[model samples]
Target chain A: MQHKQTVIDIRNLSYSYVNEETSNRVSVLHDVSFSVSECEFVSIVGPSGCGKSTILKLIAKLLDNNHRNIGIDRSKMSFVFQDFALFPWLNVRENIGFGLKMKSLDKKSLDIVVNEKILEVGLSGSEHKYPHELSGGMKQRVGIARALAMSPSILLMDEPFSSLDMLTAEKLRIDLLNIWTKYKMTVVMVTHLIDEAVEMSDRVIVFGPRPTIVKKVCEISLPRPRDKRSKEYFDLCDLISKEIL
Target chain B: MSRIILGFHLTKKRKHIFTTSFVLISIAVIFSYIIIISGDNAGQLINSLMLSLFRLVSAYAISLVVATIVAIFISNSRFGDMMIPIFDLLQNIPSFALIPLFIYWFGYTNIMTIIFAATSILWPILFYVLHSLKTVRRELDDAAKIFGAVGIKRVLYFLMPVAFPSLVTGSIVGFSIGWEAIIGVEIIGLASGIGQFLNTPVGNNNNQILGISALLIIVFLINRLIWMPLLRKSQLYAA
Candidate 1:
């Protein structure tokens, strides 16, 4: 809401997978522009095949740029990949401590922060097992911990928990809200689950089909520890649902 | 507790390995006994086996070093593109066919023989490493970049572990190929290895070099019995 504190400013941001001359080109995002405030927890939801993932990839700098030029202020950016891309070689502690270790964390503080995140993500007592050893939910929890440990200026997650069962996803959604509240870390997550965006996001931005555009942005003023069963919450969910389905 | 005793998959005791090797030695001793009863030619077969083992070890070691260094060079520079097709061409040239040319150049020396053997074997290791570097998954690279792994350490951390399975795989193939190779180098070129010793009387009036041919079979047996198992277990770990 405050222009002065804006962390991201995207103007005339357009992307197409094919060259301009090609009539067959699919323009994924057209004239897409938006500003994210500092520590903003923004969720982008779209229909199944929309380019919501592509927007996250663009934010994370993983997208291949054929011609569209992307411009963003030079602040640290990190992504928690869609499928929990934990280094299979490392165990939980090493994986959580990875970004910190990369930036060269001092040994004592690294151990403390790593231990804290392990406990934070509810992944306690499993630091020695590699990613291959962990369950799917546990692996995603490891992914969340690793991203949080980086202490990045912003976080971009592409469908981070879509693969998990409903119960685990619901639990993680609560944990995600808690982490966002505590850290005030800016986050942009992609999800097809309607209630997920409504329950956790300050603002939910929906992407459109094929030639993707920001179809909608709904501001949420719901109270903390959101009640999904509440009439207002379900209303917001249903309203957002029709846009996708 | 029972699993602790023998480990995950130990069907036999440590004593079994010693006993097996002992039985093998006993079989060799019995044959030597027959040789001694028949006399002289039996002695040549024993000498030939020892010589072949030494030559194979020396050639393999040299080949491994050459391959690793060449692979490292290809991985880091523009020369990599050219080296691949060159190596492919070389892979077609049989190790034995090179012997006559090697003798003309390096001239009837062990150096010429070892070089010929090494040229035949180096391709697999070089190609394996080079291809591994080229084929690392994009997500893994992204993971590494996020971790701030850059430069040589990046390759060491991300690339090497991913490449390790291929590296070990290629080395095993190369080692197997090198075994059959030493015989060609030894017999065709000049000097002393089991192949030369076998070639000796097989070419002459005496039929005892036929006995020396037993050395080739012994080498084959040793490769399968000793080296192949070790390589297989290591490959399992690498995989």
Candidate 2:
């Protein structure tokens, strides 16, 4: 098999969250290192409070970098947050075009781009509706559309579907994979759901409890349209879960 | 969509448009008439009042700009973190205490009146802006950074919009304080203003009470026509 090009490389990354009130530093990630290849769907899964989300933020360069070595070939990245992070004041169309507007795109081009993404994300009729007017699933769809509008090489998602109902999550996951296939971008997702990690990712990087370390990296050899009930799929889920437990 | 009519949310689309237009036209007509027709006595009083109001509005605008800029800088810097307590201490010093120095520097002119009112307006606006800036969600900030929102663009797009509700709230409080401060400055410094009308008789014997009534009406009109609309408009941006 031909080796894929590495898009991200992290070496000896260590981080701690400082409690403002107490001035106490709680180590979250410790000497953590991982690599992501171009166009690969990778999920970081672990027990709750294992700093799975912290790893994503570190990769996105959201946190301060005084304590770690992290490298990425891509200059820009986009995020789909758990809470959907849609601006409450902006309607669907405006929310989707936020990044493009920040880049100072012309009004005509911005309108075209925003409209295209809104349609692509299945929020066509809801363009005029505010975040408060949308259902949870629709809100996440808008969030995903906003991230995609930037056309980043790497997409970072922190618990993107954790807030949705089971059926909604399942549906969104399938739709997301379809979008991923079309877009052909590198995706790094942080999730607590082992089955989700196994189902969606080409590779699953498991994390241990804080201070977190990479416990295991599991490759899912299951074919596309993975069956959740299949022995191979369940086995992979079991393996990743065991590493966390 | 619902629209505001007579301070109530009206559901009928057609009626809302009609009412909104009527309200806008009526306000414009009333203000225009007030500006155009004034007898010599009423005209002088109106001119002084208008001048005082213009000073307050201009000073308030300046306060907004300065407070937002200072708040953004301080909220983003470590040095600023240490200075917040010192800032709180500075705010506690009475604004009137600065009036003596202002009078000495600017000499009881319109500049002094404006500066004094601005000082009164500045702290609440600054503190509220700082609080809003500090409380902005980590996710939103990260989102902004990841998407290349920086410098003035960042302030205009992310910071200001997120801090808008606080800004409006702070402005309401600041304007109230500004009104009081301006009146005090005019009365003390012997500058001509609406406050001066209150101290002396207008047109006839013992019209001081009438002047006070006019003052109350002007305050009510300003609050109704300007601040209330601004507050309502700001609700669209408020989180």
Candidate 3:
């Protein structure tokens, strides 16, 4: 296999959360090490409370990392939260425009970029609408639009489609794949759905129960427009599910 | 193009008109009283009413600035650990109890009156902000962090908006306290204000009725114009 450039490198990464009331520390991720290649679509799959989401946060630099060996090589990174995390106070356009404003982009350029991302995410007509007015799928689209507006080299998503219905989630996953192919950005998604992990990712990193350890790393060699009904796809799904279990 | 871009789905036009009319009526009445007093027709009643309202507003503004900064500090620092307990105890003390200390220090002047009203208004606003900070959703904080929102940027874009609903409610409560406290402070201090107007209603003076009418009008206008609009905005934003 050709050596792809490493975009993310984690070695002996451990995290513990402190209880404010009891003053006790509980370890979440322990000595977990993994690397993601540049422009790769990767998914972290595990059972609940397995620190799969924590790993995404660690990569996004949203969490305090006392562990010395974690390295994210990307210059720009953005996150799409599991809950959609759209600001209820802001309209869709403003929500998408927030990171650009944070970066101090001038108004004219910010508007141009926001409008482009809004169209890319298929939320053009809903720009003036608040998050409360949006459906589950639309809200996640706005979340994706907000993350993409920053034009980040790496996009971290925490179960972006988990909150939507099966039909909506399927549609969003396909849309995301198409967008990813065009944008060619590194994606690190955390999800519990084995089928989703197998279908969307170039590689799947399966995590064990807390304190988490990297249990398995599975690669999917399935071609584009992947057929979930295929025998190979089913077998791969089974393999990933077994690894998660 | 600018109108379309800045389109805010605000309250209904009719509702805004109604609130505006209510405020305008209060202002008209207050102005009429002021005119009458200046002409020696109402005789000190309008001055007293205006004086009380002025003291309350100034003190209320001070309390707002003080409470917001203190609330932010307490929520964001180790200072919070010490300050919160102190507040917990301070809130237990009746705000009116501070009147004696102020009178001794400032000699029953406007300064004493303003400080008294500020102390009365401060606690509710501070506690409301603290509570709002405590209840802020984890997802929003993470989102803000990922976007590189820090310091004043975080406060302006994230904390203030998140705390807004509670903060507005606290301000309304604070206004109510200041309204009553300013009058009481004036009455106790025997200072020149609406409380004095209420105290001295000589027969056939008609200052009594005017004072009472002006007092009610001011309260009604403040609720209609300021608190109601803010409350509506908060609800819509929270939605």
Docking class of 2: medium
C-alpha lDDT score of every prediction, in listed order? 0.74, 0.84, 0.86
Using lDDT as the measure, the top candidate is 3
Give candidate 1's chain B TM-score. Answer: 0.71
Q: Residues A45-143, candidate 1, lDDT per residue (tens digit)?
A: 988767788876776666766324455543477777767878776778988887788777799999999998989999988989887788888999998
- In model 3, where do residues sit more than 4 Å from their true spots? A20-24, B1-43, B201-208
Q: Residue A222 in model 1: shift from native, Å?
A: 1.3
Task: Compose the digit string of candidate 3's lDDT tens values, residues A47-77.
Answer: 9999998888777777887635778854588
- Per-residue C-alpha lDDT of model 1 across residues B1-239, encoded as one tens digit per residue: 87876673365556667767886787577666646653555566667667766666677778777766676667767777877887888788766766778788998776776677777667787788778776766666777776676676665666666666666677768766776677767765647766666565445534343444465456556665766676654453242
Ranking by TM-score: 3, 2, 1
Instruction: Please give the lDDT score for candidate 3.
Output: 0.86
Ranking by lDDT: 3, 2, 1
Q: Determine which window of 10 residues in candidate 1 chain A has minimal summed lDDT.
A: A66-75
lDDT, candidate 2, A206-243, per-residue tens: 98888999999999989999988899998898888889
Q: Which has the better lDDT: candidate 2, or candidate 3?
A: 3
